[model samples]
Target: MTNFFDQFMSPTYLGVPLMALALTLPWVLYPTPSSRWLNNRLLTLQAWFINRFTQQLLLPLNTGGHKWAVMFTSLMLFLLTINLMGLLPYTFTPTTQLSLNMGLAVPLWLATVIIGMRNQPTIALGHLLPEGTPPLLVPILIIIETISLFIRPLALGVRLTANLTAGHLLIQLIATAVFVLMSTMPTVAIITATVLFLLTLLEVAVAMIQAYVFVLLLSLYLQENV
Candidate 1:
């Protein structure tokens, strides 16, 4: 009961709700309906440069849809903020949980499926099992395709959750080590502190990298299926 109550009311639970609010607040404050600058030239040029950079850095993740590309970039930004928040001494990283990552990943996979179906309803399922497949292999191919479809979101969730959890656990272990060393050797503690700080910087990089990886994979899946 204690564990259940704590899980329900913990900062980890609240943080995700707050993050969703944060994501939507900007739209509310700037209200696109009243905006005169939705397609400003400067913004377009900026997006162009950013897209070009992402194309080079995330070669495999790139899909041809401009709208999907923009959304993918935004998702990366949001995930990066949430992941890096854990490094702030007192904050929690919600993405470290498989459930939270699943929340993001499942929607992405669903969107790909729904949109792909709508865009090409007559052949969406057919695309998965491909034509010219052996008559005897049709049933096998269908099952394989179904499993592959399910694995898309599963892989996405596992990758993000594992990376974020490992990074946070590593930071915690290093901090514990530093504290232990401080008791027996002052110089060792100082060295450990420096190393820990360096690792914290690396964690920030990992946060950004993982976010990119998630978004990139999402885009790739959408492109292939849609």
Candidate 2:
């Protein structure tokens, strides 16, 4: 029997070639931007979503942080597209890979920390030791806070990976059950297939939400720094 987990593994052609096609597929599907009096519905809807999301995300941030508007918006869209695409038949989710997730999380998280340290060193270090820390417990609290700070990126990566992996595994299990029962118990199989369809819908929501949460948390982190 094929291992259900095997689907999560990264596949390659000719020695693990970069999944360039999968990465670029979403961009290719997007309607091109046009300069005209009026635009198509798809382009208009895309513009509205981008505008709304950018406004909401930057609302809490200061004017200086507004510089990141483009980066954050692009990141959100990229993650959302990649995640939704993964749900298609025979497609692989690159976000399910810890390496890829960490590659995203660590640099962004580190950049926030760097900005905090460079721009507002006092306030940033102040986060390490809370106000009115007891004299005797200061060392312990500082060490704990430092550890927590470092753990943020790991948490980000693991949360995305675990959620995607769990949802996909559950869908696969239910699907396999449906297939197995079809030959002998057509009625039960039909019911199972219905449940599977519902689960797939739920997974679609999950994929979108996880991508949002990932970007949201990064924004919060950026807010702290800038």
Candidate 3:
């Protein structure tokens, strides 16, 4: 029903317009930097994760690109938190909105392209055409490559929006089926509920993976530019 899709819509709270609280909640929840020889398990675990992720993400990039390490890592954390939080009852996922996703994608994608053009114009332009191309196909290839280059941010935005929207719809449908069948077919309802539980677990994994992928692709873009 239309009501199922309505859950994804943004809701206003009181008189103030609020987007996903999950966007800011993670930062508030994070512990402040402390000065000590030893730290708690949670802080240690968080540190290990950030350090490991940063190392792997930056490994392929030149030293020039390392400057963005903090920004990208923060983006990854913000996305991961927003996505995971959306799985909770009564929460909205901002990433499910194409506009929000595009807003994130376009600026960052454009920045990379700009950097490439500014710092290495020849290399950036070189990406448009292959080393050896037939004269007859030159215009066609250039047009194709240009279109593809422009589509990167669009692809990024749509990919995130589609995946999250699909997963949420599936979860809602399954949950509704379980609820509707509970009295008529108890056993079937139980099975459906079990499947819903499993799907929730899968959705959790998808949330994390998608967030990682989003950031990973951005890093690759940066790698090309820097």
Candidate 4:
């Protein structure tokens, strides 16, 4: 049987890497802002969207955290673009790979933790143990909190990877069923095809939301530290 999971593999052309091309494709999709007085529809829409998204993302952060405005917004747009692109037929979704997600998650998360440690070491270390804890459970709570702290990045990466992976797998399974049932069961195949169309729409929404959620959670972590 063909492995359903093979869809997630990075595409290659003559043994050369195409993952880099897939990863960079999102940047080219955006229309560059021109120096003219009037703006095109695409540029106007892009600017408006970025402005609104930036405002919402930074609403919870303090002034200090505002420094991350550019990085966070850019990250959101990149993820959003790549995700939607993946929904297209014969395209690879880089975010579906755990390595890419973790690579993004760990460093960003570590930066937040480092900011906390550098700016206010006392408060950062105090996060391990809560105020007014009973003496007996103090050590246990410390251990538990420490474990939880370390697992944040893992949680972030796994959440993104699993969501996209499951969606893509369901899409493939249903698509395969539609093809298989077409000749033998025309009526059922039609129904399956309709279901596939609906699922595709849902996956598009999932793509956008998961990207936002990934960035949102990072912002929340930043809020705590800053």
Model 3 Cα lDDT, one tens digit per residue, 1-226: 4688897787778966468464668788777656888999988888999999999999999998999999899999988988898999978898999999999999999999999999999999988999899999999999999999999999999999999999999999999999999989999999999999999999999999999999899999888888
Per TM-score, the best of the predicted structures is 4
Lowest summed lDDT over 10 consecutive residues: which window, candidate 1? 1-10
Report the CA-based lDDT of candidate 1 relative to the real structure. Answer: 0.72
lDDT of each: 0.72, 0.90, 0.91, 0.95
Candidate 1 — which residues are off by over 4 angstroms? 1-9, 12-64, 121-123, 130-138
- Candidate that beats the other on TM-score, 1 or 4, i.e. the better one: 4
lDDT of 2: 0.90
lDDT preference between candidates 2 and 4, better one: 4
Ranking under lDDT, best-scoring first?
A: 4, 3, 2, 1
**lDDT (tens digit, per residue) of candidate 4 on 1-226:** 2899999988889999798999988898888999999998989998999999999999989999999999999999999999999999888999999999999999999999999999988989999999999999999999999999999999999999999999999999999999999999999999999999999999999999999999999999999888
Local error of candidate 4 at residue 79 (angstroms):
0.6
The candidate maximizing lDDT is 4
In model 2, the clashing pairs are none
Stretches off by above 4 angstroms in model 2 are 14-18
- Output the TM-score of candidate 1: 0.70
Candidate 2 residue-wise lDDT, 54-110, digit = tens: 999889998878988888888888888989989899888888889889999999999
TM-score of each: 0.70, 0.95, 0.96, 0.97
For candidate 4, give the lDDT of residue 225. 88
Deviation in angstroms for 14 in model 3?
2.2
